[model samples]
Target: MAHTKASNTPSPRTIIPTPVNSTADFAAQQRNMSADNASQGSGVKLKKEIGLLDGVAIIVGVIVGAGIFVSPKGVLLYSGSIGQSLIVWILCGILSMVGALCYAELGTMIPKSGGDYAYINVAFGPLPAFLYLWVALLVIIPTGNAITALTFAQYLLQPFWPSCDAPVEAVQLLAAALTSLLTVINCYNVRWVTRVTDVFTGTKIFALLVIVAVGIWYLCAGHTDHWNEPMRGTFTAPGLIALAFYNGLFSYAGWNYLNFVTEELKDPYRNLPRAICISMPVVTLIYVITNVAYFTVLTPEEILSSDAVAVTFGDKMLGFMSWLMPFFVACSTFGSLNGSIFASSRLFFVGARNGHLPAAISLINVHCLTPVPSLIFLCVITLILLFIKDVYTLINYVSYVEALFTTLSVSGLLWLRHTQPKTERPIRVSLALPIIFLITCLFLVISSVFQSPIEVGIGTAIIISGIPVYYLTIHRPVEWLRNLSQSFNLWCSKFFICMPNQEKFD
Candidate 1:
């Protein structure tokens, strides 16, 4: 790398130490990282600003977004009874914890930023990894962000149209605007993003706390009629139970989000598992109790009929102060969208760095010290997805597809264990835990086809579509596509004032 002889130039930003090699023992890796942390201002890598608290906040913020606030009614709707819905919620939390535990081992063992992509790439190989990335880039992460933004818009606008649903156009327009704004904020600085996450996580928790308190008061005041026959309408079909879990698990989706930025996290060995340990159970408790609170005021029929469950809960319970529910929901979802965007951009950035994605995606903004191109690319896709007739039309299939990939990821952990038994795990989970979670996730994916065949069919089609893309762009690239990727990569680099990840200032 060369630089002009200009006195005004700032020193080249230092990249932090790369994650320890997966084969190294945990004790040695920790010492290496501590030594690396002692030296600052050296590398071109992302800054390590996400401490343990930040990790917990990111996971909670992302998981507690729109799914909980807007459509948790789906859980009750599919489960067919209060008792069953509550059971599914608890089971979903356990399942997420189990899966997140498996990921902790992967995060510490592999210690890379792309979560499933990194693990699968190491254990399975690049082709399957690319497919996961392809589907995620298309179906999972951005779709989740779009749903969060849409819900944020709906709640923020609901206060304005007290008598009717907010106009779809207004909701979507605001959703796009919010998405764009967050993408810009994310590009500017990592700390700025984490600060927004921490602040909003607090407000969001307070909102849920109020709901739970009010509901508890209602329960204490002898409003037990809704639970008089809690098991009265429980569904017995396996498929229906699986659908209920899907609804419950969507809110639990980001439990593994912290694994996505293992490199950016302050101390992956200590903080990764610690954050998971702290965040998952707390979120599960909040979600389950919060649902219990909702039932205290809203009957089964009301929950099934209402579009915005939290807002409706507010209207029924908060009276004149109902506006606060929508306000806080907007805050919760805005944070969720920011967390998802921050994590997923790093996924693509790492993927590009590893040669699975376009090189331009790996470029770092010289001025912003962030992956500007990936953030912008994600924002553009999210905006396009946001404008579709129903931004969350794919929500029907999104969780199903997510379950499929996570299953694949955990299976990779099992594979790594058998293949490389000597590798030291920083936070080893019980072998039986991954086996149980694996079986459960497999059941969810299989049962989803029976629950909604057409939607699952579309998701399967999307996954299959990636096979050819892998061939054309990666496994064996053709002349034209490779050239196009090169030309586009150069244009992006120049226009963004960016340099490749491995390059540093002189």
Candidate 2:
């Protein structure tokens, strides 16, 4: 086991030290790592157990979750037509691919675990990075988990409530309970989590592929009625289109999830881009065709009326096996929620390691080698958010904040291109790609203000609220406050059976 270095203040960050052995960094003076063998510069000791396939499973599992099973309804509603919704799905996939490629450069170059927070910290500095962390840890991460959990609970409860909506209290309680269960599982074992991810990834993909096959067969059996007016009712307003994208892009949210655990991925330089290449196109295709499948079997009114589209599709198509659809969808969402919890905890852990969050959150369990404290904190917040009733509203808040920070991240990437011209980039993307993605994403963030002013304003306030938190928490603390923080850290260490993360034990 590694001995943790105790500190009251956050670590200084001219560079985050990633140790090769006991004490020496992978690089003498650097935050950026190069090539397949190099580890991320996160300093905290986490294993590289994730292979290329595991990486693919992680991205696919997380992205293809409740969104695909759930978001088509929102896409169809906001897009105002089956045709427009399909276009949004395709465009969102392309947009995700572009942004992911930009992140590939950032991941291979910096190879850090915190994702946007790490990239922003290196390119801009801690303040901007901390602000991203603030919105993410509070609003984005928990709400996403809450949404997934709620979706899972809804589907799991569907067999009982075959005709009507599940009770609100029942849904919320089940969601909270499920979130807690996954958190405990995550805190127990890292390898077990990946194994669960791999298995569930296959299950969800199979479920989606089943839908696509059935739809294709239905399409081939001379059922072309739904294609007569594809563009009929498409929304022309930019705000509505962007809102549709919020649903579409929300389904594609986990494309960059692998970057959050860069340190845990084996041969990141080779595996990261390879996983993205293999996973993105496949996920995009499944999403589009699955929506096509939905329209093929069910009318737009039917889709709009149902809460769980996939379940309804199964019910209409699967006959006596209708129960199996809910079962498969339930398993799919369980895996997705698991993946979200896994990746999000790592983000908070890395943030704490950099001193942007509570010092206790940086600690790794001596026995399990997972960041138990961070996982628990994430579970607590997610459970709290599960109390919020509107799942779609959570998705919008997630999308709104998601677009804002991702735009900032690409902006930071461009800044790095100007500032660190000579940095070794194992995977450098074209400058034009990030620029185009940045502009397009910025538009999505702005367009939301016109459509959902209250949500956008609330997102803005959440981000701005981080300013005071940064100043008070990370920047300056009075003597008594510092002492109180020390005592809190001590209690957390003793209770959680953890110590601060170190580069190496020896």
Error of 2 at 466 (Å): 1.2
Instruction: Give lDDT: candidate 2, residue 174.
Output: 91
Backbone clash pairs for candidate 2 read 2-505
TM-score of 1: 0.91
Report lDDT (CA) for all predictions.
0.85, 0.83
For all candidates, what are the clash counts? Answer: 6, 1
Best by TM-score: 1
List TM-scores for all candidates, in order. Answer: 0.91, 0.89
Error of 2 at 337 (Å): 0.7
lDDT of 2: 0.83
- After superposing candidate 2 on the true structure, give the runs of residues whose Cα lies further than 4 Å from its correct spot: 1-44, 388-395, 504-506
Query: Residue 154 in model 2: shift from native, Å?
Result: 1.9
Worst 10 residues of 2 by lDDT: 22-31
lDDT tens readout by residue for model 1, 1-506: 34456754334452322333232332253345334434543535577889999999999988888778877898999899999899999999999988888999999999888999999899899988998999889878788788888888988898789888999899999999999999999999998999999999998999999999999999999999998898898899999889888889888988888888888899899999899889999999999999999887899999999988888999888989989988998999998999999998989988998888888898887666789999998999899898888656776766687888899999999999999999999888999999999999989999988889999998888989999988988889998887778777766755776656543311
